[model samples]
Target: MLISRNIKMADVIHMNYFTLSVLNRFGIELGFGDKPVEEVCKKHNVDIDFFLEILNTFVDKDYFPKKHLQSFSVKLITDYLQTTHDYYHKVKVPEVESLIENMVDSCYTQKENIILLKKFFDEYKQELLNHTHREEEVVFPYSLAIEEAYQSETPDKSVIELMNNYSIDIFQNEHDDIEEKLFDLKNIIIKYLPQPKDTGLCNRLLFVLFNLEQDIIDHSRIEEKVLVPKIREMEEILVKNFAKK
Candidate 1:
């Protein structure tokens, strides 16, 4: 169901608990006292429409509103994406790492395999960090520049030059399949790794891994589906105008 302003904030959480993380990225906390979505968003100074769109897209996998999401400013979208990166780095990554450490500790017979599992996850984590770092340092700034130049009546020649040097198409083409390694990690745990003595630890680790995988998938979808295409459209317009000049 598409989230709306009139929907209760707490009810939204009930609808999909994953939204709690989404709310956190928005800097929203959970003490709204039965207020509606609009009220809570307003209190938190969030863009109600954007929040609703993001929530609806997250909750209902089939409900991506590409055009609507694209209509929002690039800064708004990128800001949210950056916060998500922060969450992954500061919270999710550490949490997963700790879980893996505990899982390895709980294992007795498959010490080598568990050590290998840690090695695999460590590699994946480094790759993920590198991926997000590139976006934060390069792609996101380029995208923001494109938006700024596109909005300007007199687009800057420098930004146009930057566009000429790098295009969203190039980034899209070079986009690493980070999730592939994650899927492999999951398979290794499920199919190959001997059952850890603490079954609960094993289960918890798998659960967190699955959640992280899905979250990353959703995050990438926004970049690939919305951010890239929107920037590409602006790049075309800016280039055409620059050529005319």
Candidate 2:
């Protein structure tokens, strides 16, 4: 995203210990553990400048990608996207479910609407899982095939035909719809719903939704601006060559 910071690599972990997620977002492992950020970057082959900009995006919601794939690895981005999907399905979604349970039990007086909210969140989770499943099962595998084919000196014509048949643009179309459900869930909780008497429970539910919103925003941007663009460019090259042949 935006490269608003000129911070040193060693200083990043110090800025926010929780920022290790940023490194994970870049497909960098945290084997560094308590080590300096610079050492981690060096070990991971992470470009220092890229790491800070990505870190800034999470730190500040105002950050936007000025030039998304420049000097970035498509494989790394895809790996990071997959990691994010795993986090969503495993950690984020389940955490929301746990909070919903806590809210329901703690606020029995307000169980009806909270149950409805939980039902809605369940559907939302299914939608998200299906969306991610499509990416992992179809889009990503096809994209990787294209990357392999196009990178070769003599690209595979059959592979080009295969990748061309299933377009990334298809996924792009409904990305907003998937995101809209989250927005709907958040709004329902914030405005229209009958909240529980336990203010902490209500607040916890809202907080989880808020964090999910921000995470999804960054996740979508990477897919839209970085991964899709790179794959599209490769698709264009492979198709053009296949046509000439």
Which parts of model 2 are misplaced by more than 4 Å?
Answer: 1-6, 9-20, 24-39, 45-73
Tens digits of lDDT, candidate 1, 6-65: 999999999889899999999999888899999999999988878877777777777756
Pairs of residues clashing in candidate 1:
none
- Lowest summed lDDT window (length 10), candidate 2: 1-10
Residue 108 shift from truth in candidate 2, angstroms: 2.6
Output the TM-score of candidate 1: 0.92
| lDDT for 94 (candidate 2) | 96
lDDT of each: 0.86, 0.73
- Candidate 1 segments exceeding 4 Å error: 66-71
C-alpha root-mean-square deviation, each candidate: 1.8, 3.6
Q: How well does model 2 score by local distance difference test?
A: 0.73
Compare the candidates by TM-score and give the number of the best one: 1
TM values, all candidates: 0.92, 0.81
**Candidate 2 per-residue lDDT over residues 1-245, each given as its tens digit:** 33333344445666665466666656676445456555566677776545654566556566554564255655666776898899888888999999998887887676888888889999999989998998888878887887888789997568856865777776677566567888998898888977678888778778878888778887777677666777788888888888887
